[model samples]
Target: MEDDMLTCNSVESPGPPFLDNAASSVATSLRRCANDKLPVSDNRDTTVSRWRKHCPTPIENDNIFEIETHCKDPELCSTLACDIYKHLREAEAKKRPSPDFLETTQKDIDTSMRAVLIDWLVEVSISRKKVTEEYRLVPETLYLTVSYIDRYLSSKEINRDKLQLLGIACLLIAAKYEEICPPQVEELCYITDNTYIKDEVLRMEASILGCLMFEMTAPTEKCFLRRFLHAAQLCHEGPALHLEFLASYITELSLLEYSLLCHVPSLIAASSIFLANFILKPTKNPWNTTLSYHTQYKPSTLRDCVKVLHRLFRVGLGSNLPAIREKYSQHKYKFVAKKYCRPSIPADFFQDASS
Candidate 1:
């Protein structure tokens, strides 16, 4: 009986001098490790095997949160009910690019150059409809492609001559990551008008992967928007497609402005939802407890970001980025670009919305 008691104590103890604290604290940590739902595994081998199969290998300095289940009901799962928000918060905190990711101040490139490159890439992605025979690139792929470009550009210094090559390489990487059957490398070369050989594209891909340290899972605005949109739906049971389209336009516009890079994806997402709600339902409050609890942003907190997004939207009305405009101008997108992109927002709308 004594030997059994000793074994049980050894199992219950958290195994380290620092963790050797009150039983309550140790129990809390163990609960957290099990996502606060189940008791810790008593069988050490079973615990190890379970983690090996289900949990991702921990990275140094990563605040890893164990998600209990995949969120099928976006409202309950994404909000305070499940571990999704905790996981998202930890992932965003862990994966955010450094503030000085861009070395353009010392290099030949500048923000204007980056914007132009991104604009051209947007055109290329849209033009894929005419170039590719079978596959049409999805919006997620475009977002990811741009993300890869920005992260890679922030890390590596390159001449303007190779900028298009870099864009193509990033697109290939994104397609592979997001698409089921990505376009061929030779096709990607052809889309660039053959300015870059297949070998050069392959080499640039290697260089980008090396610079990024194989970290391609950076959170994009779309990831957060999905959850926020679901929360918005819980309150507004009306047709959500309009708000979704407008929010997407807002997000895409954000992608063009280099200054916005300083903001995290979650902030951009929350602000977009707030803006969309303000425009669609002028009388209703754009935010509430559910949104705040899930997105970690109150209405006042989203004010500055919403203002910035509003400025970008207004400016984009007159800007020369025709690809985005034309893409949204299509009937399938409900002409959201033409309908919503404008210079004048009523001053009283902001005043009323905030209150």
Candidate 2:
């Protein structure tokens, strides 16, 4: 019995202290996001600004309590859900920031490295599309990968050779966090056409985990959408299903531009839900009396998380970059591509890679 108790305690205990540095780093990122309105906005210059006008701004409502109460009836919520549709329409209006803009200003990557990274990014974009289409991966998965990669590269000097490996690792980590049951190591290896061995992938996974401090509970874009969808009472069998697809689309665009990260997930989710509602139910009375009655908050008065995400989507659409179409292409990867890849980090980012 004593041995059993000891074993249980050991099993439940948090692992080694290598996570301390990672935890501090992530904490710093989160703090920066909180402090600055434009925290992640740096990488998205020239290519992102055009979409600013295209994103929809939800109508300001004085009474959030009314919106909340009206949401109790799922049917009314579905029809009145104005956030998602507005977001999509807005997203359609703007253009994505060019890949060149990111390549130009990033401290870690020079011109040569940027060009090389773009090639790998093309592969990443394509791989993500295939995986999402085939496995029904959530848009959040791709978003998480972009977030991870962006954060990692912010301070690292990753070599062009290992870019794809970094992308793969990011995707794998995201799948484990967002998917119901992630594909096994061998399965992922197979998917990559044996470009990476199972063990190599595993090592990359460990490296990623170590970097993020294994603290994974940051609210995803989906989490926010679900909250407001439920609060607005729009989640029904038919509407809920369609709304999910729209949410995925909205989240996918946010990945290319990091500025959206500055905003709260709740705001983004709310905007997407409302916009989707509007798109699906166009003729429904825009004047939802229940909105003012149930909602305790004001849409326009609060921080503009939804508006930012919507803008990013619009920017990508305007850029007319082949990423959207190219992302869906199903091409096999080459083995040499994986073996020569290096991390996209600067030397000073981490004192110890193993940790």
Candidate 3:
């Protein structure tokens, strides 16, 4: 099967690599900031069927790894996990922000300004800044906040002056939904240097909720990434945890690229997993039958998205927006932001074994 995407020259690097990726050590397989490349495991030669898929594989093969064994953990919602996630998948469309809002609706702002707002939001959530203590919003809250900003912008037009205010209101609303102890509205107001009064923030919050029809439970890339990572982890023991962090790093990088709005959350999650696997284990095929079954996407389906994300990875390494790169480079996150891979993915990797 010929991949027509390669001939299109979509993945070709226009200039320098973009995304900021690095990792902390968990023994020898993981690398520190100095090691630009992730060292392949000593067991790289071992053939694990779960990590590498084969055709005509028995039906029980995929289930055993993701369900039969993983669901045994007491913390997991084992009995209802499948049904719960099934519903989330069904609900993604309703929550998806307008993919082309910048072109169709907004007259005052463009992609760069939206990118700037997201960068600021990242700082508001996790960075150490003006406040005596960091605000520390959850990752889901940030994703939801961005969704709210985009969804609200999809229908309404506002000038650049109010963009930051809209971001503040969205973050407050998202923190309320996803955080156990949400931030005080006044504290959020403080984060903005009191640019908008308390009442103004509250009014924007009301506007956002009303515009969204009060539906706050929309699914995000992070929501589906957890499930896809479970399937991707299967039997890969040494790199499992690092894989999660690295994949997440890739997904977050995509948030800065407004063009990615067109792709659905599930596709973004699956593509991030694919890219992370290649970065960590370049010698082996990244996508297996298990991933295909779980994500309901073929390697071919993820071709364009993976390439676009890789472009972000290459460009974001030295991007002006340093919040995501700086945060992920910490020791706790395994320093995934600094982990480097080959400049370009091989065109053939997108093809299945059967192809």
lDDT of 2 by residue, 65-108 (tens): 32333444555443334454345334422312223334443544
Give the local distance difference test score of model 1.
0.71
Q: What are the per-residue Cα lDDT tens digits for candidate 1 across 90-206?
A: 777666655455554227767676677777777766656433464577777877888888777766778888888888899899889988888899988877778989999999999
Q: Which window of 10 residues has the lowest lDDT sum in candidate 1?
A: 59-68
The order by descending TM-score is: 3, 1, 2
Between prediction 2 and prediction 3, the one with superior lDDT is 3
Q: List the residue pairs that clash in candidate 1.
A: none
Question: Best candidate, TM-score-wise?
Answer: 3
Q: lDDT values of the candidates?
A: 0.71, 0.49, 0.80
Which candidate leads the pack in lDDT?
A: 3
Evaluate residue 198 in candidate 3 and report its C-alpha lDDT on the 0 to 100 scale.
92
Model 2 TM-score?
0.47
